[model samples]
Target chain A: AQSVSQHNHHVILSEAASLELGCNYSYGGTVNLFWYVQYPGQHLQLLLKYFSGDPLVKGIKGFEAEFIKSKFSFNLRKPSVQWSDTAEYFCAVNARAGNMLTFGGGTRLMVKP
Target chain B: DVKVTQSSRYLVKRTGEKVFLECVQDMDHENMFWYRQDPGLGLRLIYFSYDVKMKEKGDIPEGYSVSREKKERFSLILESASTNQTSMYLCASRIRDRSYGYTFGSGTRLTVV
Candidate 1:
């Protein structure tokens, strides 16, 4: 079975501060990676996804993640974060042959103004 | 844009009561999933359906059952609601292809007292 782990449980940052949330998955075979964000009182939305191609993928709101196969890591990063970025972020993985997704424990990010 | 709509934003039920949560998708997606979200737990899959009348057990399906008589709608049922079942329920849908990510609903917050 595939499992995802997010080491960070809570993150606090100020406006204009750099942000990075760690995400790692345990799956030997090929897999698809995704990052979803849930804002306060809002629905969960896709931040980005990596199927195949370049290791680095850019997403909305100037967020990006790098897929490092050797480490089985797809860490989400942003150079500067705004107060509006406060929300919970989830990392998910889907085995290449499976249709279901396994999600991480999630990281709650609080961006202060 | 593809949209997944959960029937209720908030629900309150008593313990041992039979509770039903409905989900519908605007897009004709072949796959639909039910998940429960709790603080720090992120999202845990409860059940999923690949096609009409077809259901598969997800990570946590012990206290839950699902019905999918139609392709666009999937229902989650709690045979006997428990206090531990109080959480935010989310519904998501995706096409058969593994490359694409999921479209999520606004979620239903259920409190079992």
Candidate 2:
């Protein structure tokens, strides 16, 4: 079974601060990676994904993630964050052959205005 | 726009009561999933269906059952609700080929008293 681990449980940042959320997975096989964000009173929406291509992938809202296969990591990063970035972020992994996704414990990011 | 719709945004039920949560998708997705979200726990998969009437137990399916008689609809049932089961329930759908990420519903917050 594949499992995802997000070391950070909570993150607090000021406006315009740079942000990075760590995500690691334990799966030996080929996998698809994803980052989803859930804002207050909203549904989970895709942030970005890495299947096959360049290691770095850009997502909506000035966010991006880099898939480091050697380290089994796909960390989410942003050059600068805004107050609207306050939300719960999840990291998920899906094995190439399977349709199921295993999600991390999630990181609650609170950006202070 | 394509969407995954959860029937209710909030639900309250007593312990030992049979509770039903409905989900519908307009994207004609072949795969649907049920997940429960708790603080710090992120999202845990409860059940998933690949096609109509084909259900698969996910990571945590002990207290839950699911019905998928129609391709666009997936229902989660709690045989006997408990306070421990109080959490936000999310529904998601995706196409079969893994070309894209899942589309999630707004979620149903269920409180079992």
Candidate 3:
């Protein structure tokens, strides 16, 4: 069974601070990675996705993720986060044949203004 | 804008009552999924359908059932609601290919008391 693990439960950062949320998945095959963001009182929205292209993928809202195959990690990162970037981020993974996803325990990001 | 609309935003049901949560998509997507979002659990997939009337069980499918009679509509059913089953349920739709991102609904928060 494939499972996703996020090391951080809550992350607090000041405005313009660099951010990195760790995500690791337990799969040894071709994987599709995704980052979903849930703002306050809003539905989950896809920030970015990586299917078969380059390891580094850029997503919406100035966010990006890198798929490290050997390490089984696809961590979300941003150079500078704003107060409006405060939201819960979730990392999901799906294998080539898998239609559903395995999501990591979300990381709640709070950017202080 | 593409939308995946859930039937209810909030629901209260008894322990032995049958609960139904409906979802409709306007994008004419080929795949739809039902997931439960908890505080520390991220989102757990309950069921998904690739085509109409074709359902597949996800990671956690013990106490939940689903119906996909129509292409644009998918329903989640709880035969007997329990306290542990109380959570925010979300519905999402995606295209046939994995490259497309999923569009999620606003979610339905259910409380079994």
Return the top candidate by DockQ: 1
Q: For residue A96, what is the lDDT in candidate 2?
A: 93
lDDT of 1 by residue, A1-113 (tens): 99999999999999999999999999999999999999999999999999999999999999999999999999999999999999999999999988899999999999999
* Model 1, docking class: high
- For residue A56, model 1's alpha carbon misses the true position, in angstroms, by 0.2
- Which pairs of residues clash in candidate 1, taking residues 3 or more apart in a chain or in different chains? none
How do the candidates rank by TM-score, highest first? 1, 2, 3
DockQ for all models = 0.92, 0.84, 0.84
Rank order by DockQ, top first? 1, 3, 2
The per-residue C-alpha lDDT of model 3 at residue B86 equals: 92
Tens digits of per-residue lDDT for model 2 on A1-113? 99999999999999999999999999999999999999988899999999999999999999999999999999999999999999999999999988899999999999999
Candidate 2 lDDT: 0.96
* Residue lDDT tens for model 2, B7-31: 9999999999999999999989999
Interface RMSD per candidate (angstroms): 0.6, 0.9, 0.9
Report the TM-score of the second chain of model 2 against its true counterpart: 0.98
The best candidate in terms of lDDT = 1
Off by over 4 Å in 3: none
